[model samples]
Target: MLRIKKLDIFVLKSFLLLFAGTFFICLFIFMMQFLWRYVDELVGKGLEINVLAQFFFYSGLTLIPLSLPLAILLAALMTFGNFGERYELLSMKAAGIPLLRIIRPVVLFCVFLGGMSFFFQNIIGPRAQKQLWTLLVSMKQKSPEVDIPEGVFYSDIDGYNIYVKHKDRKTGLLKDILIYNFSDGFENAHIIWAAEGKLELTADKQHLFLHLYNGEQFENLKSQSVISRNVPYRRETFKEKHTLIQFSSEFNMVDGSFLDRRSDIKNMHEISVAIDSLTTHADSVGRSMYSDIMSTTYRGAVLTPADSVKIKTENIAVINTDSIYNSMTSQEKLKVLTTTENRVKSLSTDWDMKSFLTKDTDNSIRSHRSDWHKKITLSLACIIFFFIGAPLGAIIRKGGLGMPVVISVLIFVIYYIIDSGATRVAKSGEMNIVLGTWMSTIVLAPLGAFFTYKSNKDSVVFNLDVYAAFFRKLLGIRQSRHMFKKEVIIHTPEYAKDIEILDEISKDCQTYLETHRLKGMPNYIQIFTNNKHDDAIAEISKKMEALIEELSNTKDAVLLNLMNNYPFLSVKAHKSLFDNRWLNLLFGIIVPAGLLLYLNIWRYRLRLEKDLRVIIKTNQSIIEQIEKQQLYLQK
Candidate 1:
């Protein structure tokens, strides 16, 4: 049995609210995207209210799987971001609650969401997609609303291009109308000119009724007779005339059962069944084609007992076709060559046709296989995105929609790009479908793990200062120090001890310079394998810092100003290449990278020598200033 704590309840409540809101927001966004893609189809079809509602409703249902992952990602980010911003996360951690424990409730909820996503994708999504796509096709096939504008050719009507010069808005009359009708064929076109006309839909709405006044109609007689030149036509003038054109304005739906054959409009079980059937059909077709080709190739061949013995003894007779062709008459040779060529071409064409039979089956198998993997991959994406978003939010410590929204969108875009690119490649048969389908998950799982680890350890993963310092050290950039004279002396420097320490530091620097040749390149082996330590530099730095701390309290402005001239030494700058011994050894084993690291180490070694030189010169100068002050005081 599981017990629910207040903390768990608090976390669940916060996450659930954000999840619900973000889910709908994501759903709405994806639905709008769907609408934008098919807006042209839905706009002029004059679909009923119920039909339009069903269209949007089915589209939303199909988009639910896509929306779920992004929604989870945004919600997780916002939930944890709000917690971190308000220091609630910090307080929980302060109470000995780990980051993972704090996020336990949300993680469980994400798992539940994943299951829900799987259910929808495997069950409801297929049916909705079928309905949605069927409706889209119906909408696209449906005719546009009849709205003929003035001074424009209205070609939306099938087989007719009607140009209206003017129209009476109140009377619903078209003036100076010119029409081209090629319903039968272009050669049998009918051109008409009418002084006035009016168009209206019939009662059944399956035909357009055109009433014309003072119209002259010209009907081409070219199609009536097969005359090559001087084609004749018939003409008629009428005071009033009516023509019935086949134009269906009523809304009609197409048979949606055709969409059942698509891979996307199938459940996991259906896809599996499809894949198996296709594979079996492809195999049988391949075996049959192979047999046919083999039989055709060896159609007239026979192996005698002597030829079999020759085969066993590896002494088969070789025929010289050139000599045989030379022995034959020209007509006989041409007859044989023609027969062989025809046989070869016939076999090639037959093989091509047979190969096409299995090609479609193989493609169907691949589609079903890819779709099967898609259901599982989409389900796993929800849980994976939670790990990424929650830890990333805690690291950024930014709450509300502003920062989290931007970050979530960027991450989701990256995921979408990878998923879409890989899916296309996989579907094209250029890549293994399973690997391509899982490529996005494989790429992001490690990132999620890294973020979670860093968040749990409370690492400053995005601290710019830390990164800047590392790069500065890597590039051997010099840093300056600032020192000031104290207003009140808390512990004034013992000038005698300070002088002695300065002398000691200068001697140690001189000794180190003499012992180590810092101008030369670092040893490759030592940089990688050996852990190089500079005790002299470390000790000198320690003494220099201690002496500076004492002298900073000095009332003498000159001595205080001179303290700023001390070089800030990096005590471990000349240490081993990395803190990890194994990693250092690995780098050493990689020759090209080891050479680069070797040169970088040499640069650090050179920088260390310069720092020591500056430290020694500055130390001597400070010592002379202190001695001069003492000498003047003694006088």
Candidate 2:
């Protein structure tokens, strides 16, 4: 039997409360998004309160798999973050408790959550999905309530358009009603205008009755020849008239099996069975298509006469089309050509439809198989997210919803993006369904293990200074010196004079740019072929660094500010050469490389121009600051 310690109970109590709140928060967020999609179907249909409640309930249940993983991730991040922020983790470490030992309870609970997620997916989720969609389809089928306002044309009903000039909602009456009925056909349209009318639903809500008083009706007589310039029509006047329209207002749920047979409406077992059945059916259709192609299209078209099998036409008469066409008179030939064109068109259309059906069926099978793999992958994601979130929170050591929420949401968004992309690829048969479905886990599990290891060892995995240094090295950039070294000044003179050092460097750079033709395409081509620009740029960079170093000994604040701006000039010809060499080698010498290299060179040129501007401005500021310092000393 297992034993429970006080520490275990304490951790569990705190984590479970946060987990429960976070789970519902995730559910509410997803439900809001769900409502956005189906609001059109639910609203204006006047569905019963219980019916709406059932719809939302089923929708929430169906979203369990999606919400569970995100919830676990956020809950774990918050739980550990709170512990780290409160110094509980630090206290535990000082007490000789391992990080994993502290996290053992949360891990066990997450494992149980993962199992619950799996059960929800396999059993409750599918039924909820079926009921949700069934309700949705039923809502769409029910007639929209007749709330036609005044002075507007409403075309909600099929094959009918109605206009009401004035509506009296209190009296349930419409004045000056105009109705256009094209149910028979557009050419045989019937138009009715009424002085006053009332629209009401039948007791069973299966039909609409329009009772009109002082109405006139006119109907076109389509029996007249279409070539006649004038259409024959009939008109009638009535003191009272009525019409019955077929409209179903009741919400009748579709046969449960209709959408239940869809890929989304099944567990892994059912989906696997569907996959097999669809596969077999698809195979049979393909084989039959291949047989028809071999027997019909290639009947007499083979290169080898002996190998070409003559397709039999039992109980069918065959005619020599070419000779018969040649023997036909001109009029007869026209008739034959027209008939043949129609026949060919019909055959082409039939084959096109068949090809479309075959492709659709193939995609359906892939979708089913992909959904089957998703059942397991989604459950696995909950455990993966817990592993990642808990260790990362421990390593970061900051608490509450601030940093933890951002990190958790960022990680989950990345996971969702990868999972969505993989699902699309799998559904399109670009990759195997299982591999695509598990791609996120395969990519992130190692990362989770690494975080776990680092957290257990108390490593600063989220340390920004370390990462900053590494990034600088990777990009071949030199890091800036934040602290200035104390230097002994051998001479203290001339604070009033203008600085010639920055001016000289700026002059040299401007002169070099003016002399060198690094602007246009011709100059770009010339530079790469034993380019002297590279050597010149490299020399200028060295001089700039040397100038900044000598001036670093100065105690002038403006001079120090100017020195801070000099390191940006380090991003020059050398870094671009080596940094982009990998690009050229991978993309090759011509085509993509040529265009890309050209663009990169132009970008460097723009940066060089910006550097010259900075140099000139810094020299001017140093000159002004020195003048100010000299005036202050004199005062």
Candidate 3:
């Protein structure tokens, strides 16, 4: 027990070290994203140090859940990778330590972290998001700090474009200023130019005042009321001039109370409550609007009691809209129709707007529910990542940050893409919110478990050799060499006995080839029904193998080489007997089975014919050598 604990502690220490590094790295990445998204709000706002610090603080907190899972994934990957790369995993496994036992400590730690993440998401994270979003929104309304550059038209101001050829920043003096004011509309405008000017902000910082010296103003005095164009223009030269532009420089925060708390900023519990409230409200609104439309259009007909529906009463005066219109003067008829049309248009517009509102409410409800599920789902991701990373690392057996980082990033990207798609689906209400929010976890959890299972069983899931072979076969670019261990033969062949056997096998093969026509159409039924004929091939194959063995025994290099040149009998026999199932299925489907079987038989016959030719040539050569040896022996 003590030894096991020590081992687990050692493994955990390494994992934690990597976790610390990776967690901060993940957080930094998310922080950079936050910066990019809100950089415009932060750049020239002149925010205080405390405010900026607070933003970073909340941003980091809000990003914790996101970063935790990735950190765990990377840490587990790195730790196990180190183990496998160094062959420490091999030693442990040899010592009977299972993969699960090796990763137990890290798994427990991840679970603990997952719980902490949940706590933060449910309790602390909401507050941080609320504050962060509030601050960001506040900065949006705050005016951009004054940064007017020279040689460019500054159109940050509404309805105005002001340009300065040169400005002395130290002295805060502008030279050769041009300002265009289109506040009254582009058709009528005022153009102002100054030899020298100074820009200043009002005491309240609500307005920008441009004080100009030796300037001129041009105003086009063409009233929109006048039909004629280019009627009048006014240009005035002045010793000094002042124009005020509306600009708010103060930093005013929006009321946080008015901000919706039911957004993603809410905690799971709060979100659930919000969902319930929204659902009830949406139902009530839809019911009320539909009821109003029906009641107004049909005058309570649809709301009739069951008893009234059943009653067959005498003929009643029905409303004849055509006759009512005919009874009226054209003016009165026009008025009545105008009123009815307006009423119908109003009802239809109201109905459409309400329907849209109801759908929007439903979508919001789904979003909130998804957010609630996400709190748990993201927390669960930490655990899932640990299982995945640890086993994957073990399988890959790569140490350091290089391969592990690449793998972790790829996995996380896949996960995030799936999560994003699921969230969109949930938001659109095409899928159940619970399933949608948990979809990534659902997909990933089993994969992690499978990796664990493979690791525990010592399965070669990441054996590059296996993958390489598969791809090689797929591309038809590689062949595998099956090595056979050479045997140490104690005795040389009895040439007299081996020669007789080889002669007999050769004669049989030659006769079978010469007498049969390989080009004939095959009886496909015989393929299945004629196991009898198949055994004959097997028998011939066995006899061929015996001859090759005898030739190897002769201890003659030339004869051994000849035997080596011959195809393996087992390979030739089975080649026609069975093929890749995919090819068989393809042939069976695309062509009639009889034709396919016949074609296969024809192919096999041709193959047999070739093999027989090789055998016959080999036998002839051996027979000549035996005759020469016998004559020498007689001499």
Cα lDDT computed for each candidate against the true fold? 0.87, 0.79, 0.80
What are the clashing pairs of model 3?
Answer: none
lDDT of 3 by residue, 263-328 (tens): 667887789789889989988987887788676656643235553454436443464667867999
Who is ahead in TM-score, 1 or 3? 1
10 residues in a row with least lDDT, candidate 2: 307-316
Candidate 1 minimal-lDDT segment of 10 residues: 296-305
Model 1 misplacement above 4 A = 223-227, 297-357, 471-500, 521-529, 548-575, 578-590, 620-635
Report residue 552 deviation for candidate 3 (angstroms): 8.8
List model 1 lDDT by residue over 1-635, tens digit each: 77789999999999999999999999999999989988865687778898889998999899999999999999999999999999999999999999898889889988998998899999999999999888889888888888899888999999999999998989999999999998979988999999999999999889999999998999988645465677889999989989999998777789998887799999999998888888887888888877876665664333456765776698646856689789999999899889888977887887688767777777777788888999999999999999999999898889899999999999999999999999889887899999988899999999999999999999999999899988877787767888876677878779988888888889999999999989987666677776656677888888889888888888877888888888878766565766777899998889898777777777778888988888888888888899888898899
Per-residue alpha-carbon lDDT of candidate 2 for residues 1-635, written as tens digits (9 for 90 to 100) = 66889999998888888889989999999999999988886678878888889888999999988998888888888888888889998898899999888888888888888888888888998888999988888888877887887888998777889999998979999999999999999988999999999999999888899999999999988765657788789999999998998877777778777785688889888988888898889899989988886776556332245433332324325546688679889999898778768867876886898799798988888888878778888888888888898898787777788998899889989998989999898888789877888898898889889999999998888789899978875554556545364477765434433366556767877887688554544343432443233566667677767766666666776667756765455444522444344453444356566666656666667656666667667667766776777788789
- Whole-model lDDT, model 2: 0.79
Model 2 per-residue lDDT at 180: 98
Better by TM-score, candidate 2 or 1 = 1
Which candidate wins on lDDT?
1
Quote the positional error of residue 322 for candidate 1 in Å: 6.1
- Candidate 1 global CA lDDT score: 0.87
How good is model 3 by TM-score?
A: 0.75
